[model samples]
Structure formats: structure tokens, C-alpha cells
Target: MTGVVGALVEAWDELRIHRLRVLLALIGVAVAVAAITAVTAAVDMLSQAMREQNERDSGRSVTLQVNAWPATAEAASTDTEAIAAQYDLALERYGIEYSSRTLYSPVPVRFPDGTRGVDMQAVDPDLGVINRIVPVQGRWFVDQDVDAFAPMLVVNEAFMQSLGLSDLSTHPTVLIGDTDPVRATIIGVTAQRWTGEMPSAFWLYDQFERWWHVDPQMGQPAPTLAVWVPTDQADALSERLARDVQLAAPGWQVDVYDNRMNGMSGLDGATRWIGLGFGVFALLLGGLGLVNISLVTVRYRIREIGIRRSFGATSARIFFGVMLESVVATLVAGFVGVAIAVAGLKAVPFDRLFGSALQDTPPFPVSAALVGLGAALAV
Candidate 1:
């Protein structure tokens, strides 16, 4: 240990003496490490951002979507209601924790000035959880919101702007109904990112069914039940739920759909491939920079090596000492680079930078920093 320590001290002294050379090597390693680290972290952030965007559009990972229709095309108005009851029953039977019923209906809303058709969605409270709905303004519906005399509504930013309603402090009401307008309170406003400029609103599924007369004769969308389960159990649970629903409502064609396929296949693989290519390029740059420094270092340190050899330093010791100098110097440079990268990322607001793409991504991924340091050491 003492001999090793002595050799390390000697190697460090040589590095201190060759100030210009060490500076050049350190600069190269630092730049390379920072480049690799920043690229890795940025790619990871982008991937996560895209993930959040997709989840908002579709449901979250391992989400099971069930589309059920009564066998007879010309069904009584009672049939849709019965079908919903059976679906809800099946959900309870399976002990599903997070589930939502989405009933998409184009309802005309009457503003103070004029009325327009808006995409009104009726959903259970869990719909926001399954879809990861983070409101920029207020919040999603809660269980207590269901019991209110008037159906609680969450509107999009565009919807609020269209109505020319600025303040959300005082609860505002919108007239939404097929016949005489059933007044619904706008409790919250969502950021206009997921839903486009088109006006949109959300109401409690149960309240909408109770208050609004959704005449099946008018040709409206059948409610879709979105269920969230563990990723490993999604397929199995969905299949079982389909079987149960069929038994619950005989003559009902139950179709279980996996919404995650499109998101996972289309977005994840593409981002991974793009990131892998860039990561490799970064690794090469870092390694090549270190290799160049090491090559030049040996030529300059030949005199130092000869003197150490005269003092009984073995060939292996000399070789390892040279390597250690590079490792120590590069390691320090790697840390500096990582610090700079972190500072750079923090200086610029990533959330603002990504805007819509950014969601729930941690301020910085420590793993990416560690990986950067490791890659620098390898170089």
C-alpha cells in the first residue's frame, strides 16, 4: 500500500509539473464528459416528456380499454343504461381499483352571448388518475364532486377563453343539455395542451347520465370504460373482464383494447434508437480525447520514467503509474464536466424549454450524471 501510495504521489507530482499538458488533457476530457452527459440527460428528459404527452392523450401504461355494444342495433334507451350498469358491476367484481367511464357527447353550451357545440366528456374521478391529468389551474373532479346538486365540470383553457370568462375564483356555470339546458358548474380549468383549441369540458359520468337525457335514438357515442392495472397483469385481467362482462350482459359484444401498444411501439422505440446513436458518438469522442492525451503523455514523461526506473520502480509500476495519472486527471475533469452540465441544465428552465413535452420529469436524473462520470473514467 505504501509503495502504491508513493507511486501515486510521484504520478500526481509529474501531472502538476506538466501544467500545460495536464490543462490540455483536462480540457479535452471535461468537454467530452460534459457533452456525453448532457446529451444523455437531454435525451432521457425528452423521452420522459414525450411519455407524459402520450399518456395524457391515451391512458397510462398497462391501461385496458373496453368497448361494449348491445347486440341488437335498434336497442331501447334502457339497453345502454343496463350495459353501463353491467360494466360497472364487472369492474366491482374484478376488484379493479382505478377505473373510469368515458361518455363522449357533443353538447351545445349556452354562453351569455352565443351557444356553440363543445366536446363534452363525462368521466368518473379516476379518469384523471388513469390519464395523469394535471390541471394548470384548479384540479380534477373528486368523489365528493359527484354528490353536488349541479354536476361539477372541468373545462379546457380554450373553452374558458371562448366563453370570455377570466376569473375562476367564483364558480361559473354553463348550460349543457340536449333539451332544456342543465346548468353545470365549471370547477376547474385544464391547460390547453392535450385538448386543442376546440372547446371541451368534463363532467361526472354518473351526474351526466342522471341529469342529461342522452337519447340513444339521437345516435351518441357508447361509453368506454378505461381500466388501469399492473403492466404484467393487463392482458390477463382484460381477457377475464371481457369474459365477465359477456356473462353479465348476455348478447353484448365486448371488445377489450390495449391502448398502450401504439404509444410503446411508436414513441419509445424511436426515442431509444435515436438516443443510442448519439450516446455512442459521445462515448467515442470522450474515449478518443483521453487516448490522444495518453499517447502524448508517455512521450513527454520518458525522462521521468527513466529516473523512476533508476530508483528501482519496476516496469509494471511505471506503466500503471502513467495510467493512473490519466485516470486521476480524467476523473477530476469528469466531475467538473458533470457539475457544469448540471449547472447548465438548471440555468435553463427545462420545463419551460419543453413546455408541453415536459411533465413530471425530475429536475435532473442523477443516474445520467453518474453514467457520465463513469464514461469519462473509462475514457
Candidate 2:
């Protein structure tokens, strides 16, 4: 170990003496390493953003969607509350941690101008976990919101704008329903799905059922139960949930299927490969330039090498002494580059870059730094 330390010290000393000759090359190497590391981290964040966006649409990985509806007109009025109960029981039986029952209906809201019908979603608090629903301002629903005197709402940006509200700072309230408009407070605002999406809001399932009357023509949409489970258990759970739900709600059409985003692994893989390819190409160019500089430096140092040989230095010592200079220089460069990359990434506004706040924002991947360092060492 001492011998190795001495050799490393000697190499570092040589690098310091010849740094002026290799300064530009070392800078190139540092830039290349930073580029590679940054690209890797960027790809990881992009993939995470894509995954979060998909989760908002279809729930997270291994999400099982359960649908149950009456098969005949006579059974059309099948008790939805009972179905929800059965869904809860099933979830309890499996000890599922994240599950939510969601139903969609339109409710009339007394806006400042006039009463307007707005799209409404009745969902449980767990929906936030299963769907990665991050509110842009304020907070999502909690279990306590269920017992509040009035219903709580989480509306989109458009919904808040229609009510002439800038934010939830004042705890905005809007009257919902036409008969006896029940006052609902807007606790959160979510980003619009598009620039001009219609005003929509989410209400807790139980509160919505108790407060909002279902239209006869627009009868309550069938509730879809979303349960997030382990990927490996999805197929088995899907089959079991289908059988159990069917038996629980007799004469109803019951279906269970995986609703998590599909075919994204391929796209993520391609993106990573493409980004890595660019990084590697840059690294090669820098490596080639460094190699040329090193060759010229070695030619100029022939007398120094010969003097060491005359002083009884073995061939191995000379070889290692020469090689360690490049290694030590690159290791230093890699460290500086990685530090810069980490700092730059931390300062990035990821929410704006991805168009949404990432629920599980990936940390600076350790593997990315490893790759950068490994490439530097290879060069």
C-alpha cells in the first residue's frame, strides 16, 4: 500500500510539473465528462417526467383498474354505494395500500358571471397517490377533508380562472349545484391538461355522493377502482379481483385490467441509448485530443525518462510512473466535472422543463457519475 501511495504521489508531482503542457487536454476531458454525466441525469429526469405524466392519465406502474356496471336496464340502478363497499372490502382483503374509487359527473357551479356546468370527478384521497396528482398550488385532499362541513375542491387552472380567482391564498369558495347551491372551497389548483381545457374539479367520493345530485340523463358514470400494486403480482391480482368483484356484485359486468402506461420501456431505453451515444461520441473526441497531447508531451520528456532510468529505475516503475500521470490528471478532471454537473442539475427548474412537478424526482444517479469517471479513466 505504501509503495502504491508513493507511486501515486510521484505521478501527481509529474502532472503538476507538466500541467501547462496538458492543460487544454485536461479541460477538454473535464468538459466531456461533465457532458456525459449531465446527459445521463437529464435522460433519467426526462424518463421520470414521462412516467409521471403517464401516471396522471392511467395511474402508476402495475395499476389495476376495476370496472363494474349493471348488464340490463332493470339492473341499471344497481347500488353504486354497495359496489364501492365491496371494492373497499376487496382492497382490505389484499391489504392494498393505495386504492381509489373514481367517478365522473358534471355539476353546476354558480360562477361570478352565471351558473355554469363544470366537469366534476369524484375521487378518494388515495387517488392522489395512485395517479401522481400533484397540485400546483395548495394541497391535495386528506382524510380529514371528508368530515368537513362543506365539500372541498381541487380545480384546474381554468376552473380557478373561470371563478375570477388568482390563487387559493384567500381560500376561494364557489357555490355548487342549482337547487340549493352548497358552498365548496377551492383548496388546490392543478395545471390544465391543455391550454383551453374546460373547467373541472375533483371532490371526495363520499362528499360528492352526499352533496351532488346525479342527473337522470347523465346518470352517474360507473366508478372505476384504481389499485396500485407490485408489477409481479398484477396478473394474479387482476384475475382474483375480477372473480371476487363479480361474485360480490351479482348480475353486473365486472372487468379488471392493468391500466398502467404500456410500451414506454422501449421508448425510455431508446432515449437513454441515444443520449449515451452522444456523450460517448464527445468523450471519444476529447480522448483522441488528449492522447495526441500526451504523445507529444512524452516525446518532450525523453531526457527526463532517460535520467530516471540512469538512476536505476526499473522498467515497471517507469511505465507505471508515466501511466499514473494521465490517470491522476483524469481522476482530478472527473471530480471537477462531476461537481459541476451536480451543481448545474440542482439549479435547474425541473418543473418548468418537464411541464409538471415530478412526484418521484430521481436524485442525481450514482451510476451516472460512475459512468463519467469510468469514461475518464478509460481515456
Candidate 3:
């Protein structure tokens, strides 16, 4: 340890002695590290944004959708609701993970201007967990919200503006239903990524069910369930869920919609490849820069190295000294570059820069900095 410390001290002194040369070499290394950080961070952010966008368009991969279609067109929606409720018990038993049932229906909501029919969706609060429905202003619902007297609502920017509201701090309330406008409290504002200027309101199912009347038009659209399961377990769980539903209701048609089957089910694999490829590219660049610097440094110190050898320095000590200098200098340059990159990212308005598809610009990807440092060290 003492020898190592001595070597580090020597490396620092040499760095100071050859400050201009070291600085010039460091510039290339610093730029390379910075580029590595930027590419890695950008790749991660873009990939996640794309995933959220995909989930918004299609449900999440391994999303198990249950369609309970009764034979009779005139069957009351209440009957369908009861059948759907049966899965809750079975799910708990199987320990089948994350699930949300969404009921989509046209609902009349009164804005200050006039009442308009909006795309009303009632889903559990955890829909954000199952699918990425990020909040722009407020928070998504919680299970405890069920006890609240007034219904909690999550509205899009367009819907909030349509009602002449800008600030989300005050818990805004809106009226639902044509004859008697039942008041509902606005709890959260969804980032406009998915809705994109469309007027929509998301509600917690039980709360919204109290006021919204379901007039059976060809029997209300079956509750589309979004179920999350491990990739390996997805097919089996879907089968079990469909079988269970069929056994529970003799005449009902249980259609399990596999979103992955549609296309691009290989997103996980693709993400891995993207990360690996970017990492290789970054290391390649950084390695070349560091190698050039190391070569120049060795050439410049050849006389000093020879003098040390003449003074009885072993080959091992010389090798260790050279290696230590390269590593310490590279690490220092890499850190400086990381600091520069992080500061530069601070100026970026991620939402505007990446477009609202990425609601909030994520804090600088820490993995990026780690990868940058790792590359600098390895080089």
C-alpha cells in the first residue's frame, strides 16, 4: 500500500511537470469520455421513452387481456362485472402479478364552456405501474383513495384547459353525467405524451361507477384486463386465466389477447443489444484516445525511465509506475468530462428537447457516468 501510494505521488508530480503535454493528451480522453456519457445516457433515455410510447399505443408486452363476451347481446353489464370480479380471488391464489381492468365508455362531462362527450376510462390507480401513465402535475391514485367521499380523477392537459384551469395545485373538480352532474375531484394531470391534445379523463373504477350509468349498447364493451407476468410464465398464466374464466362462466367467451404476438416482442433483447453496441463504440473511442496519450507519455519519459533503470529500478517497478500514471490521469480526465457532461445536461429542457414523448428529462443517467469511468479505467 505504501509503495502504491508512493507511485501515485510520483505520477502526480510527473503530471505536474508535464502539465501542458498531459493537458493536451487529456483533452482527447476527456472528450471521448464525455461522448461516451452522452451516448449512453441518450440511448437509455430514448429507449425508455420508446417503451412508454409503445405501451401507450399497444398495451405492455406480456399484457394479458381478458375479453368476457357473453352469448346474449342483451346481458346486463352488472353480470359481466360480477364474472370479471371472480379473477381477483384466483389471481391472489396463484400469486399472479400486476393486473388492471379498464372500462372504456363515452362519458358526458361539463366544462365551464359546455358539456362535451369525452373518452372516459376507469382503471385502477396502479395502471401507471402496469403501463407507463406518467403524471405531469399531480400523483396517480392509491388503493386508499377508494374511501374518499368525492371521486378522484386524472385528466389530460387538454381536458384541464377545456375547463378553464391552468394551475394544478388546487384540487379541481368537474361535473360528470348529463341530467345530474356528479362532481369529481381532479387529483392528477397526466403528461400529454399519450393523450396528445385529446380530451380525456381517467378515473378509479369504483368511484366513477357510482355516477356513470352504463346503458348496454350491444352489452357494454368487455372489461379489457392488462395482466403482467414473467416472460416465461406469460403463456401458462394466460391459459390458466382463460380456463378459469370459462369454468366460472359456462357460456362466456374468454379471449386472451397477447400483445406480444402482434410484433416487436423482442424489445428486451433489442434493448440489450443497443446498450452493448453503444458501450463497445464508446470503449473503442476512449481506448484509442488513452492509448495515444500513453504512447506519447512513454516516449517523452524514456530518458527518465532509463535513468531510473540505471539507478537499479526493476522492470516491474517501471511497468507499475507507467501503468499507474496512465490509470490515474485517465480517471481524472474521465471525471472532469463527466462533470462537464452532467452540467451540459442540466441546461437541457428534456421535455421540449425530446418532445413530450419523454415527459420529464430524466436526471443524467448514473449508469452512463459509471460506464464512462469504467471505460476510461479499462483503456
* Candidate closest to the true structure, highest TM-score: 2
Write the residue-wise lDDT of candidate 3 on 58-92 in tens digits.
66666778877766545433366556667786678
Model 2 root-mean-square deviation: 2.1
Given candidate 3, what's the lDDT at residue 198? 79
lDDT of 2 by residue, 290-374 (tens): 8999899889889998999999998899889888889989888888888888998999999988887787889899999999999
- Per-residue error for 342 in candidate 3, Å, reads 4.6
lDDT of 1 by residue, 97-159 (tens): 999998887788887678888888889999898888877778889999888998788898888
Q: Which residue segments of model 1 deviate by more than 4 Å?
A: 74-78, 194-196, 263-266, 286-290, 357-359
Q: List the global CA lDDT of all models.
A: 0.79, 0.87, 0.77
Provide backbone clash counts, one per model: 0, 0, 0
Worst 10 residues of 3 by lDDT: 72-81
- Stretches of candidate 3 above 4 Å error? 1-14, 55-62, 71-78, 112-114, 137-139, 144-152, 168-173, 179-181, 194-196, 230-232, 258-328, 342-351, 356-370, 377-379
Record all residue pairs in model 3 with backbone atoms less than 3 Å apart, i.e. clashing: none
lDDT of 2 at 35: 89
